[model samples]
Target: MSRVSRRRFLEDSLIAAAIAATWAPSRAESEGSLGRKVGPNERINIAVLGVHGRGLDHVKSFAKMKDVAVVAIVDPDSNCFEKAVKAVEELGKPTPKTVQDLRRILDDKDIDAVSIATPNHWHALAAIWAMQAGKDVYVEKPVSHNVLEGRRMVEAARKYKRICQTGTQIRSAVGSREAIKFIHEGGIGTVYLARGLCYKRRDSIGKLPDGPVPQGVDYDIWLGPAPKRPFNPNRFHYNWHWNWDYGNGDIGNQGIHQMDVARWALKKNKLPNSVISLGGRFGYEDDGQTPNTQLAFMDYGDAQLIFEVRGLPTPDLLGVKIGNIIYGSEGYVAFTSYSTAVVFDSKGQKVKEFDGGGDHYRNFIDAMRSRKESDLTADIEEGHLSSALCHIANISYRLGSPQPFNPRTKAFGDDKEAYETIGRFEKHLAENGINLNEATYRLGPKLVLDPEKESFVGSAEANALLTREYRKPFVVPDKV
Candidate 1:
C-alpha cells in the first residue's frame, strides 16, 4: 500500500475502536427524550458553548429574547464566564449557570438547545453530542473540522429529528432574502460565476514558545477533538483560527460568510465537480500554518465559484472588502455586508439595492417551536454543503507542492476567469511587497470529485483528507 493509504488505514482503525468503545445510543437517545418541546408560552432554555468570543453574542442575543432563556454558559476557559454572566445580568435576565465543559451539561433536561460557537475542530462533535442528547443545535459556520464530520452532523440531526440551524445568519437577513429572491427571479440574467472575497487584513501571530496552560482553563477539554500538545498562546483563544489543528484559516473563518453567499447566488446545493487552490503565507512568516493569501476555484460544470482570501492589506473589488460579487450574463449582484446587497447591470449602472436585517436566533427558536426542519432558513444540510466546499478546497491545497508563480500556464484549461483571477492574485501579492522571483506558491492539483459520493475520484490521499484522525471519546462517529 502507498504511504498515504497505509496511514489512512491505521487512522481509520483507531477511529473505529474509539467510536466502538466510547459511543452508544441509549433508549432515551433512541426515543429522542433528551430534548423537550417548548410550548408557545414556555421559554426555550439554551446553553451558549465557547463563550469566549462568538458565544458571548449568543448569550446577549438569547438573553434579550422573550421566549428564550440563556440557562447556561459553557467554555473550557472558566475565565470567560464572568463577562458572559455580566452580559446576561446586565440585560435584566437571571444569572446563567456557568460550566467549563460542554459534556457536563449534555444531560440537563432543562437545556433545550445548544448554540455552539466553539472552535472549528469542536463544531461537529459538539453538535452531534448535543443532538444525541436530544438538544437542538445552532452551530457556527464551517460547521465541521472536515467534510465527513459535516455529513455525520447532518445524519445525527436527521436521525434525532432535531431542529438544527447553521450559523450563517445572513440567510435570516431580510435584505439577503430579497436579494436571493431577485437572483432567482432572474434579476441577474443567467448567472454563471460568483466571486467571494475575503480581503480583511490579518496581522501575524508572532512566534511564541510552548508554555504552561492558563489558569482556570480546562486544557484537555479545550483540546477535545484536536490532538494533545503543549499549550502556546498562538494556538489558543482567537489566534487558533490560523492553526490547521483547531481552525480552517480565514477561508473557513471570515470568508465562509461570503462563500455561502456565492454558492447561494448560483442556487447550487451540491458539491462542485472539481476544485483547485494556490497560494501561500506571504509578506511575513509566523507560527500560522494556513495561507494568508489564497485563491480557490470550484468548478460546477455550467457555473463556477472563485473565492479569494487576502490576509494582507489590499483594495476592494467593486466596493466590497469582504463580500460576494455574483456575475450574470446581463447584470450582477454585489453584497456589501451580511444584510445588504446591490444589483448592477452589465454597464455597471445601479439597478437596485437591498438593505435590512433579521434575527437568526429568533428564526431558530421559531423552527424549534414548530418542530419542522423546513422552517429553518439555514438548515443543517445547507450548512454541510457550504462547509464542505471550504474543506475540499483546503484538502486540495494541503496536497499541493511548491511551484514558482506562472501567469501564462493553462492550469485552469480554457477558463479565462480563472486565469484573470490568478493575474489579480499575483498583482495583489506584488503590491504587498512579495517578490515572485524568489518566493514560490503552493499550486494544488486540480482534483476531480464525485459529488454524489462526496469523495475524490481516484485519489486515496484526497479521500483520506475528507475526515481526520479522531481523539478518543471525542470522536465524530462513522455511524451517527
Candidate 2:
C-alpha cells in the first residue's frame, strides 16, 4: 500500500478499536420515502457524531423528533459520550448505543441519516463519507473547513442524491425566511450591501502543557485529517473553535450564520469578484490561532457584502444585536440572530417585520419526513457559501503582515487599532493579575483576494494555509 493508504488504515484501525464494543445493528424502521407511511410508528434511525459542544443539542433535538430515532452517538471524548448516553436515557427511550468512531455508525445499514456536529475540520469528511455510505446528512454550519472542501461536499450530495442539510438552523426561523423573502421581493429595494456582525469578547485558552493523550480519548481519531500536534487542552475542547488546525475561528464558528443570510438575501451563489480583509488577534495572550477582529469585503457585480467579526465576545458590537442588516436604496431591515426580523423604509419608518418561530431542528425533521429538499430552509450549499465568506476573510487577513513591534520601546508602530487591540488585551491581563505592559501584537498586512478562487491572488503561503494537510486514512475523496 502507498504511504497515504497505510496511514488511512492505521487511522481507521484506531477508530474501529475505539468503538468496537458499542457498534450495533441498524434500527431504521422508516419507509422508502419520507412522506410515505412505512409504518404506523416508523422512526428514522439516525447516528450522531461529535457529541460534545453542539452535539448535545443535536442529540436532544433528535430525541424530541417523533419520527427520528437516534440509535448511535459517536465522540472520541469519553466525557461527551457518557453525558450523551445519560441524556438519551433521561429521554425515557432506549439507550442510544455510544461509539467513539464515526465509521462504526456509518457501517450500520440501519441508519437512515447521520447528524454530524464535529469540529470544523471534520465536518466535510464526515458528511462526504456518510453520503458515500448511503446515508442522508445533517451537518453543522460552515459545511466544510475550506472552500474546496465545501464544493466537494456539494458535489457529493448531488452525486449521491442525498438529502444533505447544513446546520444554519437560523435559516429555518420564520422571521429570517420571511425577511429574506421581503428583501427578494424588493422590500429592501435593491440592497447593495449586507453587513454581518459577530462581535463578542472571548478570554484566552490559557497556556496548557502539552502531554500524553487523555484516558479514554482517541487522540488520533480526534485529530482526524488535521495535522498531528501535541495534545494541548486549549486546542482540544471548545477552545478549538479559535484555532486554525481544527477550527475556523469566530468567522466560521458564528459569523457564517449571518453570511448565509446575506448571500441568501442577495441570491448569489457563485464566488465574488474580489475580496480584501484585515484583522488580527487583538486582545489577550491566548492560544487562539485566529483573529480577534476581522473585516472582509466581497464585490458582486453591482453590489458588495461586508463581514465583520469581533472576538471580544462581550459588549455588543451593534448595540447588543449581532445579525445581518440589509442596506438598500430605499430602506433597510435588521434580522436578529435568532429572534425576529424588523424592517424600516429609507425614512427609518417601520414597514414590516417578522417575529420568528423557534426550532430549526424541528424544521429539519419536518423536511426529512416530507422528502423534499426545499423543506430544509438552509441547505448545505447555503452554509458552505456563508462559511466560505469567513474563510476568505481569514485568508486575506493572514496574507497581510504582522504589525511591526519595538521590543526596546514596548510600543506598536503608530497603528490606530493596533494599539487599541493591545490595550484590550492588557486590560484583561491586569484584571487577571498579569503584567503585559510589553507584549508584541503581530497583525497581518492588508491582502487582496480573488473570491472566484477563494484564495489569495498574490501570496503562496497564505493560500497554502487555506486547505489542511489531511492525515492519512482520514482523506476526503475527490469525486468530481
Candidate 3:
C-alpha cells in the first residue's frame, strides 16, 4: 500500500476501534439540510480540537453541559489526550475517544458539531472543513489568522448554512451587553474614540535552539497551513503566539476581545478607512518575531479606534490594564473584565456599574438547534471584522520602517487624540528603561483601505499581507 494510504488506513482503523469502544449509535440522528438543524432535546455530539491551553477549557465547559456530548478529543499532540480524557470522566461523563488528526472525525455522521480551540492558524481550515462536512462550529476569537482567511470562513458559513459562532465570550456577557446598550443610548454621549488596551505583561519565550520534534506529536499536522520549518521549542505549544507564521501576536491574542467590544460600540459593520501601527519587541531580546510593545491607530472618519499592546511591566491606563475605555462627549465607559464594566461621567464621577455573565457555549448550542445565524451572539462575520482589524494593523507594522523616537509626527496631522496617544507611547517606552535617543521604533505608513472590498488601496506590499501563501493539502481554499 502507498505511504499516504497506509497512514490513512491506520488512522481510520484507530478511530473505528475507539468509537466502537466509547460511542453508541443509538443517539438521535441529525436531520435537516446539511444536518444544520438539531433536535432541541437531543444531545448534540461535538469534537473538541486542540486540547492544549484554551482548548482544555472548551472540553470542561462542553462536558458539563447535559445537552452536549464531547464524543472525541482531537489534537496533534498525544500528550494532551490524558488530561482531556480525565476532564470528561471526572464529570461523570463517558470517556471521549482521542485522535491526533481532526480530518479523521470530519466524515463521522454521528458527530454533529466541532468546538475549535486550535491555534489562530488552524482555526479557519478546521472550521471550514467541519462546516463542509455538515457540522456546526464554535471557533475561538480572532477567528482567522488573516483578513482573507476570515472572509472565507464567513463565506463557508453562509454557503453551508451552518451555525458558526465566534469565541468572543464577552459578547454573551450581560454586563458588556448593558454597557454597550448604554453607550449606544447616549449614556456615553456622542461616542468619538475607543481605546483597547492589552497591557498584560508577557515574559520572553527566551532563546531556544531548534530541536527534534517531541515524541507522540504529529509535527506535520501541528504545522497545518503554516510553512514547514525546523521544530523549535519556543514555537511549540503556547509560545506559538509569538511567531508571525503561526500567530498574529498579542493584539490578535488577548486584545481581540477588547477590539470586538470597541468596534461594537462604534456600530461599525465594516473595515476602517485607514490604519497605521508602531512599536517593537523591546526589553530582552528573544526568538519572538512579533512586537512586544505596539500601538495601532485606525481611522473611521468621524471616530477612531486605537489599540495598545504592552508586554513589559506597566501601570494600568484609567484603571484598565487589559480592557477597553470608550470616550464620549458626556462620559466614558470602562470595561473592567470580560463580564463587568463601569460608567463614569465626564467629571470623573462614577455613575453606574454592570456585572453579569452568560454561557457562550450554551448560546452556540442554542443557535445550532434553531439553525439561525442571528441567534449567535458572535457570528462568523463579527469574528471576521474584528480579526481583520488586527491583521490590517499588523500588515502596516510589518511594512514599517524604523525611525528614532520623537513625540511630534505629521502622521496624525492635527488630530489631538492621535498625537497625545503617540506621545504617551514614547513616554511609556522611556519609563520602561528604553533610551529614546539610541533606540528606534517601527513607524508604519498610513495605508488607506477600500472598506467595501476590504483591501488596501494603491500599496501592493500592504495588500499582499491580507492573506498568506498556504502549504499544500493544508491550504484554506481561495473559494472555500
TM-score of every candidate relative to the true structure? 0.94, 0.83, 0.94
Candidate 1 residue lDDT tens string, 68-113:
8898999988899999999999999898898776776777888899
Worst 10 residues of 2 by lDDT: 29-38
Once fitted onto the true fold, the runs of candidate 3 whose alpha carbons sit more than 4 angstroms away are: 1-33
Off by over 4 Å in 1: 1-25, 406-408
Compared with the true structure, what per-residue lDDT tens digits does model 3 show for residues 1-480? 789977975886677456434532122221224763567788899999999989999999999999889999999898999999999999999999998878778878899999999999999999988887778899998899999999999988987788999999999999999999999999989999999999989988899999999977888889989999999989999899999999999999998998999999998999999999998999889999899998999999989999999999988888999899999999999999998999999999999999999999999988888888999999999999999999999999999998887545677788888888888888888898999889999989999999999999999999888999988667888885
TM-score, structure 3 vs. true: 0.94
How accurate locally, in lDDT, is each candidate?
0.90, 0.74, 0.90
TM-score of model 1 relative to the true fold? 0.94
Q: After superposition, how far is residue 338 of candidate 2 from its true place, in Å?
A: 1.5
RMSD of each: 7.4, 7.2, 4.7
Q: Which ten residues in a row have the lowest lDDT in candidate 1?
A: 16-25
Q: After best superposition, candidate 1 residue 19: deviation in angstroms? A: 16
- Candidate 1: clashing pairs of residues: none
